[model samples]
Target chain A: MTEMLRVENLRVEIKEETILDGLNFSLEEGVHVLLGPNGTGKSTLLGTIMGLHKYKVSGKVYFYGEDITDLTPDQRFKKGIFLAYQLPPAVRGVRLKDILKKILNIDPKKDLPVEIYNYLKSLDLDETFLEREINYGFSGGERKKSEILQLLLAKPKLALLDEPDSGVDIDSLKLIGEALRKIAKESNLLIVTHNLKILDYVVPDSVIVLLDGKFVYKDGLEIIHQIEERGYDYVRRLVYAQNLS
Target chain B: MLKTYLKEIRERALKAKDKPAILGPDIDLEPYMRTIEETPIDDLEKLPDEIKENILYSGITPSENDKAGTYFQINHSVVYEKLQEIYKGKLEIMSIQEALEKYEWLENYYSRLIPPDTDKYTAWAEIKPTGGYFIRVFKGQKVEHPVQSCLYIKEGNISQNVHNIIIVEEGAEVFVTTGCLTHLKDQPGIHIGISEFYVKKGGKLYFTMIHNWSEEFHVRPRTAVLVEEGGVFINNYVTLKPVKSIQSYPTVYVRKGAIARLYSIIYGRKDSYIDLGGRLIFEEEDAKGEIVSRIIANDSSKIYSRSEIIGKAKGTKGFLDCRGILLSKSSQIVAVPILDAQHPESELSHEAAIGPINEEEIEYLTTRGFDKDEAMSTITRGFLSLEIPGLPKVAKEQINYAVAQLEKAGL
Candidate 1:
């Protein structure tokens, strides 16, 4: 099997404060979850991998066996890497339909494929929502569903979703999980969320623990149960012991 | 009737060089006046091929069997003028010169909307006004397609002063989409356009003007709309290209139960200075007015946007909104929005905001699949997009397409 993404010795600093400290992460494919407590660098890790230039990153990021450490966000997009922002900025005049067609590389005048409408209906969003400005005055659940809708249309090789399960009701969260499950069938999914509720609807193939910007452990689906039943304290102790060793 | 006003305005034009706060800076027109006098007037037979090219560049080429109506004026002469049989049979459309000669009653409406001595430019236009159209839609009739007018200037060191008058009779509807363009480079020219629109009782008139000028063109456009009881006037104005300097303040007067909406999108490119604004006044009870101005200052350009809404009587509503976006560090945008309600029961509101394009929004677009330039264009297109209700489909699309091309070419 080919490695989809690899991060080697990744260290990130923002405003002279260390965020991600010497983190090493590897994922082959399929749906994976980065479950960690708040204040950890889960979102920061995703942003760095997506080539946000604000953070001072000293490490190498490889995607599909090629070093993509220096690529811009636009370049990464062209190379089939997409990030669903947790709090996407509101584009005052750019409509959701316009950007959706733009991401699909299709003419806005042409009819969007039927599958998109189907996905929208399944997500409980009316087609009229496409004509609205991107994320402007949208509810939290609407924002998440909008992100998921873009992910479905983008069909990227890898999707990094930051906290899709947060700030959403159970129904919207379930819809997002279902949408993620549908997308994971064709592409890779790396979800960053503090909560473990979404896993009930669509379980992850693997789970990684990020604590204090460090990758503490990586295991199969079994680890999700352990982390949920007991707090992250046990994982913190394990990481401390591992570092001491 | 003409002598009394003409004598005073010409003298005012002669003495006018500066000193109007709303008109911004002034330009010396003596040199251009001489060039314009020496040059022969261009008619259809004497027109050069470049005029056709400019017409095509403006995205609408005249056809032999064209529908609705089409009018073109170059410099001080009418080049191509046509009123489709359908429109001509019902409405009266003719050149300003022809209309003046045919109708003696037109003298009343010539400058009623904008007085001759209102500004230096208006005085100049009154003294040496040239090519413009006169349109009157008969009472109780609705015209589907707009009366298309193209005003183009080519030669340098000249002036194109035009006066247009449009009157929609009671219970009638009419629309006009005019394009002012100059393709020449380094040819210093001054253009002053005076437009007056009169909407009678229960009538509606929609006017759209798109200006595309070169870097050396100085433009001064004065416009006014008078709406009677229950009448409506919608004006959409945009400038998508570079210009030396431009100053325009359009006013709309709304009467009892009438409404006026003025929307404008102004773009200033390198070294360009633009002062664009709209003013609305409610003179009678229960009148309504709204104004929206979107200013995009890019590449060291400076833009001044002013929106004012005033209510004179009770039970009136007025709104004014001015928004600006600066695309470059050197560019600047100043927004002045004022709302005044003299009556105790009248309501007036205003909002003004000026900000630069958020870099995070650009990156957000890039992360979605657009390249840097594409992202910039998308953000700009969205920033300037204001949905003007009842705009002509073809005209709206043509203007939008031209704007998109301008954005792709980087302002």
Candidate 2:
């Protein structure tokens, strides 16, 4: 099996406050779920891995065994790494079609290709939605759908999605989950989610528990059942016992 | 009657030429008074290659295809003026001097909306006037294509004073695209333009102006519009090139059942100082007015965007929107929007915002495969792309062409 992503002793600080400290993790080429509590720096970890400039990062991030910690976000994107933001910013005057044209290198005078139109339909979005300002007035479900649509268009080697199931309705979750499953068939997916509801639509190969900026436990789908029944405090105590031993 | 009106206005202008304007830096008129003669050309192909290229940059095509009429002025001469044969009697295009000599009734609209003594620039335009276009749309006729005009300044260190008049008769509609530019890139020059537009009852007029002047040009354009009852007027203005200084505030009066909208997209670059604004007055009941302005200030440029909407009659409505972006540390942008409602039944509102480009937006674009510079450029172009309401197709195409040209010039 080939390693898709590896983070070695990663420490992230935003505005001089440490958010993720001494985090170490590695993932293979498959679908993985990241489970954490609120404010556990799940989004921050994803952003740091994508090379967002806001975070003060110290440590190493490897994509397919290549050092990528110092690369810019655009440079990282060119190396086949992508992140679906937890909350996408609203760019007031930039239309979705305009950005799509830039991403696909399509001429401004030509229409968007048919595959994107098919993706729009599968996401239950109108064709006219491409003309709207990007994320300007989108609903919660619509924003998630837009992220998933972009993921399908990009087809990167590794995808980092933050809480793709949080604000989505059940129907949109099914659509987005199906899209992620399709993406995972060709690319590795590391998704941050709070609940097991999304698990019903897309099965994961492994589930990792992150507590206090470090991975506490890693297991198959059975770990999610334990966490749901006994909660993260149980896992915390179990990890504490192991550390003491 | 035309001769008498011209004489009286010229006298007033002479007396007020020394008077200072209410805003912007004052300039001495003595240096620019020296005129250089340019021979008139009946065909556009006779223009120099550099001159033609500059005109094209301002959104005017030398071929004149798909246009209702074409007017070209170089320095103080009207080089070419032609109207498409298909629009023979429905549309009229000629030099303002010829129109004044040919029709006596033109005196009514010559300086009616904007007084010659309103400001020093207007005064200078009347005192040492150059040739400008006189366009008219016949009653009950709607011209499909826009009439294109190019005002080019070939000689440096001279003032090009021009006065233009546009009249749309009752139930008629027309679109006019004007491009103002200069051939010299670094020589000192000044252009004073006084434009008056009148829209009769049930008439519609769409006016688009693109300015592509050089770095050392000082431009002062005074424009006013009078819309009769049930008329509509839409004005679009774009100035993306470098200029030494520019100050303009076009005012419009909307009567009963009339509507007026003014849109301005201004990009200030390279030490340019631009003070652009517009005012709309609702004069009677059921009148509507709107003002929208988008400004981008870069490279130590300074811009002041001002908009005012006054509602004086019952059932009147007005709104103003002003947004700007400062791309450089030294660049400055000031937005001032004012709304006054005199009548109890009138409604007026305004919105103004000025700040640097959003970092989050830049970061978002970078994650979508754009480098830093490309991300910034994309955001800048998006900032200037405004969805103007009620604009004709031809006018929109012209504005798009102007923006594309600016982009090609590394904007």
Candidate 3:
């Protein structure tokens, strides 16, 4: 299978402060879980890979084997790389459905598919939210699901989701994970999240533990069980020893 | 373009010997043959720059400093000369002198509608031979379409004394639109115009005007409307660039139970200065009047608006609303709303709001792939289009076209 995304020795600094230090990673055509604690540069890595200007990256990034380290966010977006931000923005005077339809380039004369509305309903969004500005007054979970709705329409080759299960309830979380597992099979998934509760639904093939801007371990689902009980102390010791060596 | 047009008009005037619609002193040419035979033509090349600037500043009407009789130079004057050369016999237009000489009956009613002391510009314009347009819609005669009067100001430091008297007789309705324009390549110019509208009892009159002048020129406009009982009057005005200083005050006086509405919008940019407003006075009971004015200023421009709604009737109602937007840090706008209700039963309401565009909204739009400039343009159009529901179709289209041009200019 062809590699969807590849990062080689990625080093990023924000205002002279190092965020991602010499990170190297790749994703094939399946589910890949990226587990990390707070302040571990998970979200920063996602932003840098997506070409968001909030950080200054100093390494090469390749998408579908094409160099994209200097591409703008819009240019990268047009090349089929979607990033689901942890916090969605509020756009006033622009209706939610209208924005989605325009961005997706759907036909205006025809009705949108019922399956999309069903997904929105499953995520606890209502008709009023669709007519209002995009995420103008939405709650945390609703905003997340709106992002997912955009993801389903855009259908990017690489989906980098930043904490998809952070603010969702149990039922909605299950629905979101299920939706991802079903639709995300056509592309490579790079899930950067702290919570492991969604793993039972997504059922990752491999799990990587990122600490201090570098992956410390690569294992299977058993790593999630180990981290849940042992509480990242061993990983912290490994990160310290690696820094010293 | 101008030279070609002027040549055609000169040829037409020279060929037509039959006295065609003369607008100045009715000289038989046979009686004053010797005086016309000796008038010098070399002095007509162009007025001196100092004299042009002086006339521009002093409100360009001819004066008699020397008691040399002056010979009543009809063809040399701007109003009579231009009217004689172009559009002489096509339309029913006349200079004040010509009207007094030939149509002498009009002198009693010409400046009577807007007398000399009615305002400062009128008082000063009364010196020269003012041009007058007497449009009388007969009783119960409703013109199927509106009549248009196009006036152009070309001479430097020349005061265009136009006295427009529109009489809508009883049970008659007429729509009149006047356009005042100046060519782009013309020298520095100044115009002082006076338009007086008289709506007789049980008649309707709609008057609209659009003014476009070069920013180097100074303009002072004074117009008035007197609506009798059961009469309706509507006025709309717009001012554009190339005009340096503009001071306009359009007033409406409506009788008992009459209806009046005034809508005005002014956009200022690039060192422009304006002090414009409208006034409405109610003399009878149950009268209704409303005025809404919006102004936008940017780039070291200044605009001050002072409007008033005076109600003397017992149960009359009036509303005054003014809003403004300041785009640049150097721009300034101030509005003063005044309401004087003499009777306790009368009502008046006033409101105003001024601020910049919100930062959060701009950021949101920028994040969605639009740049800061595009976002600002969209917000400006949306803000101005909020008043489109009440305007007529042609006016609404004009506002939209103006906004498009502003965006194209990257404002």
Candidate 4:
């Protein structure tokens, strides 16, 4: 499989506080799960990879063998890189359909394309939601569903999803998981989540465990069971033991 | 009786001619006192292409298509006036002078809402009343299309003073769009407009005004409205272009079970100084009022946005929202939202927010494939695109057109 994304010696700092230290990872064109505990820099890694300006990134981030560390978020987006924010900001007065029209380059006077309409249906969102301001008063589950809907519409080569399954109800999780499974067939997904319930619908090709801002373990689905049996502390101890040996 | 009323008004105006406004910088009225030549045309096509273009930019259609009537005033005279035959009896659109001369009872409605001695601008308008539109919708008739009116200033150093009156009879409905503009940039001018609006019992009136003035123009519009029992009044105001200074604070009085909604979207550019606001006073039970304003100040512009909702009667409710955006470092926006509950059963609330554009919103848009500039423009457009409740389709379209024009002008 061809490598879709590569991050080398990635170090991120926000306001002089180091979040991600020397994180190195490479992913092929498949579904990958990033498992980590709270405040383990999973979101920072995703934001850094997407070239968000808030993060002070020191290392190089490459997409399909091209360096994109200095590129803006829009430039990275043009290069088929998309990030679904963990907590999307509520933009008042900007309707979701209007932004979708802008992203699709559709005419202002024309209706939204049928494909997006179908996506809305598949996500179990009402068509009237299009007229609502983007996530302004949306529920937690609805916000997650909105993020997934954007992911499905963007269909980027590399999608960095931050906590796509968090704060979602079981019903919405199933809908979002199924949508992700469909999009994973055409795009590469790097999903960050603490819960493994979403794995029931969309199986992961590889599981990467993040500890202390670094990828401490990388394996198949067995790592998920190991962590389920013995919490993230087990993985930390295992990685510490390996470094000591 | 009319002559006596006029004499009394003139005397009162003369006394208040030197009185300064409570807000905004005082303008020296001497420079704009010079008189300019008036051009009155019988046909709309006779208007110069340049002047017509400016009029169109202010959201007035020059062709008069889809309009119930058209009133064009240039300098101190009415250039052209036309009313569609379909609205001949149901609606009336004519010059204020013509209406006053033709109708003996016009004096009762004129200057009744806004007194002539309220301020210097009102005083000036009463003393040298130029041409303005007089529109009235007959009782129980609903005018389908909007009546378009344009107040154009053609010469430099000219003072254009006009008094406008609009009356919506019982159970009547109408929408009026007025565009006030200048002919050229940097042409010093002063416009003092005294407008009085009356909405009868159960009547509805939607008034939308767009201002496109030059950098050397000073505008002071004194407006007042009276909403009778169960009547509705919707006012939409947009001023997107540059002006030397503008200070207006239109007030509305809401009677029993009446509703008043005032929406303003202002974009201040260059060295403009704008102090715009609206006041609503609820006088009877169950009356409701709302004031919403969106202001964007760019360049070195200074804007003061104020809204006041005074609940005086029992069971009256009012809400005031004032939001402003400062696009440049030197730009300043001051938002003042005041709510006064005088009666024990009255309820009033207000919220005011003034700040620069949200960086997070801009970045969020950029992540959706929009460039930084595109993101900023999109966010700015959204900030200014307010969905005013109960606005007529034509009025909303006019407001949207003005906002789009501002975007094209690189606002």
Residue-wise lDDT of candidate 1 within A35-151, one digit each (tens)?
A: 788888888899998997678999899999999999999899889998999999999889998888888889868877788889899899999998889999999999999999999
Instruction: Select the stronger candidate by lDDT from 1 and 2.
Output: 2
Tens digit per residue, CA lDDT, model 3, B165-223: 67777777765555565653445555567777777787777665656666665666667
Provide the global lDDT of candidate 3 against the true structure.
0.63
Report how far residue A161 has shifted in candidate 3, in Å: 14
Per residue, candidate 2 scores C-alpha lDDT tens digits across B338-397 of 898999999999888888889899999999888999888778878887888767777887
Runs in model 3 lying further than 4 Å from the true structure: A1-245, B1-115, B139-144, B184-186, B360-370, B385-390, B407-410
Error of 3 at B8 (Å): 41
Better by lDDT, candidate 3 or 1? 1
- lDDT per residue (tens digit) for residues B212-231 in model 1: 88899999888888999999
Q: What are the lDDT figures for the candidates, one per model?
A: 0.82, 0.88, 0.63, 0.88
TM-score of 2: 0.97
Chain B TM-score of all predictions, in order? 0.91, 0.98, 0.71, 0.98
Model 4: CA > 4 A from native: none
Cα distance off (Å), candidate 3, residue B404: 4.0
How do all the candidates rank in terms of lDDT, highest first? 2, 4, 1, 3
Return the lDDT, model 2, position A144. Answer: 83
Which lDDT tens digits does candidate 2 get at residues A33-72? 9897888888898999899999999999999999999999
